[model samples]
Target: MTRDISGQIAVVTGGAQGIGLAVLRKLVAAGARVASWDANAALNETVMAGEDALALPCDVSDFASVQAALDATVDRLGPPAILVNSAGIAGPNMPVADYPPEYWARIVAVNLTGTFHVNRAVVPGMHEAGYGRILNIASIAGKEGNPNACAYSASKAGVIGFTKSLGKELADMDIAVNCVTPAAARTPIFDQMSKAHIEYMLSKIPRQRFLEVEEAAEMILWTVSPANSFTTGAVFDLSGGRATY
Candidate 1:
């Protein structure tokens, strides 16, 4: 069932394209005003073109940047009732032993620390509003572990832990904190991984196909919907039956 969100405010990180953009468009269509927070300044400048939507440049990896972006968002749109942390990178594909130390640092900074940043920045405002929904986009790799992708896997696992812990923190409130773990999807993030790494992911999906970005968006839409009450600290699986835990 479609939940009513006629007067809701939303913020979607990485909203410039891919899954974030998918979610942003769906929210707009559902009558919710949206802010597209992305690191791509160009995308933010040109992607959204109307009164109900605006784009703000934000690098989720940077706490200071995340804070500034959050402030700017609240100033432009009202306090966001919904926040989707979709900004992330796959990092370079390599075994943990061969992974570049610097690259590993970068991936965790964005995938894990960044998730924390978005949630920390948004939660206070949500607490003040007495209502909120936070959706973290994790991956199946976080659960089953993936070879040649140490940093990506570890960081996502951290996201799952964080989501679960935070969900419980706000369990008594109207706020909901949850995460969705998806199998590989053909997003631009694929540009960063090796062909072997990509194939490895495809071979693992029992469905014999990669997930579509829109399908991920649909799950995100519901996770952040008002109808999603009574569910927090939960992990919604979208791994083609790869994960039912």
Candidate 2:
């Protein structure tokens, strides 16, 4: 039960708000020195100002930005021993046929490719340190595709695949790479969704409610903790009984 990450350097993408911010708060409470990498630099700075954390302006979709953020984190808090890929966006909700091509590209770029960028940038340091825990934020939609959210669902599916592949590649080491498939949480991401889409999501959950950010954070913290020594290339579900698999 002692999932302490004390003294560990942690990096959380999209740590400015929502699930990412929740995870960052928990990491700090667990005694980890966390660097919050967010594209919303101003909001990140404002929110991280009072916490015992670092806010780094980073757009995870860009490898250059990811590298710079990693450099800054290493210089400030040493190589991150824990990484939580929480940076993501829920693109406009619409049927696949109606989904804008541009929106699809943007969604994948930020959600799927962005996860790759951050992981790629941080793993080397963890490898050198001989210790690391990576937790990627996937979605229940990835498992049971949401009806009008093709891009979001597809991108999250890619995250699950990416996590599994990376986890296997690093299984021989102390590093453990894993991801979580969470049901819809009522966060800022909701603003991008239509009212009917939100209702549809809520109805799909057996719990008949949305996921809580803190609940998501708790699972995320543990997944990236030292206690998660054996589990790798696995998907932890926070889907409220919505995911059959």
Candidate 3:
């Protein structure tokens, strides 16, 4: 029998644009009602245009802010049975010694701690409901450290470790937790990286191309679907052949 997600309520963090927006669209198309949380105000208008999505402004790095957003979502959309932790930031790239401490802290707060906040907020509802899917978006840099992106790489590596630990803790429950490690995808974050960094990422991929937003989002949708019952605490790779191990 095939699993269908119709009538499910899905919460997608950072669902303003790029891969996050793409995931929001796919989940809605799969018949799930979606609540999209983004820090950018424009995202609300962009994602809610002619769709059934609820767009809420949320700062994932702040627990109070994330809690408020989740509360609002539940009030408007009901309990979220599915979650995708896609909200992240790529801090300024520089050698470790040259990197600003503020930048490093910001990267860790948004990429790693932010994921923690969302998961903490939503997991209780899943536990109460006895079913859920949680997917975190990580990076290939998390697996294979990048030269000048120390903070970004470290934060993502933390996400991977956190996902594994939480997945094990909830193994006996009906909820499944997993993450995806994707290579460079064309998004606004690319503009923050140096041209050399972008070129290096492309060169590392045997496919010689950056991944499409839709391609990444498709994998996320599948991992969060009921079809993904057996693969908790696993990492899915989408590196265009650059991922090894």
Candidate 4:
């Protein structure tokens, strides 16, 4: 039996565009009030369209900034029972030895530590409510390391590990923590990479195409729904046949 998510409040980090926006739209369509936090204020407004949504500017890389944003979100929409950790940064393409230290740290901070901040802030509420759903947005690179994207790969790997560990810790609780490993998608974040790098990524996928944003969101919806009561510490694969393990 599938569970309905009506009237549930969901918070999505990086909810301004791409997969995040897709998730927000789906949640709203399913009768869930949604809040979107993004560093780009304009993008957030454009995505939300002044609906029953709060578009807040947030730098997920900074714990203090994320905490304040979470606080504001609670004040506006009440404590989020569902959280989607989608905020991330794809750093420069380079080998591990040649990757800039600052770039590596930035990627880790945004993709990994940023997830930590949001989870830390929201988990307490879920624990108190005795119901919560956390769906983390990881990447295929996290499962199968890419050649020239060490920082992004490592950060996502960290997310997978963190999700697994935390999921175990909360296994006995009502909170179900899971993550998805998606292949490259046609999002604005791709613009940060070189054409050659993009081509290289595409060629590696057996499906020979990027995963659609809608598809990713659909999976997220199911994972965070009340129907997903039995699963925790699970990693769903969206890698376009690129995932081996």
Q: Rank the candidates by lDDT, best first.
A: 2, 1, 3, 4
Candidate 1, which ten residues in sequence have the lowest lDDT sum? 43-52
Per-model TM-score, in order, reads 0.97, 0.97, 0.97, 0.97
Question: Tens digit of lDDT per residue, candidate 2, span 143-188?
Answer: 8889889999999999999999999999999899999999989999
Clashing pairs in 2: none
Instruction: Give the Cα RMSD of candidate 2.
Output: 1.3
Per-residue alpha-carbon lDDT of model 4 for 1-245, expressed as tens digits? 46699889899999998899899999999999888989898888787744467888889888888888888888888899999989998978878789899998889989999989888888989999999999999998999888889989989999999999999999998899999999999999998888888998899889999899999999999999999998999899998898856
lDDT of 1 by residue, 1-245 (tens): 44788779999999998888889989998888998889999977877866778898899999999888888877877899999999999988877778789998999999999999999999998998889999999999999999888999999999999999999999989999999999999988999989999999999999999999899999899889989998999999999988889
- Per-residue lDDT over 1-245 for candidate 3, one digit per residue giving the tens place of the 0 to 100 score: 24688889999999998789899999998999899999997756678743456898999999999999899888887899999999999877789999999999999999999999999999999999999999999999999989999999999999999999999989998799999999999999998899999998999999999999999988888888888888899989998889867
Please give the distance, in angstroms, between residue 15's alpha carbon in candidate 3 and its true position after superposition.
0.3
Whole-model alpha-carbon lDDT for candidate 4: 0.90
Score candidate 2 by TM-score against the native. 0.97
How does each model score on lDDT?
0.91, 0.91, 0.90, 0.90
Clashes of each: 0, 0, 0, 0
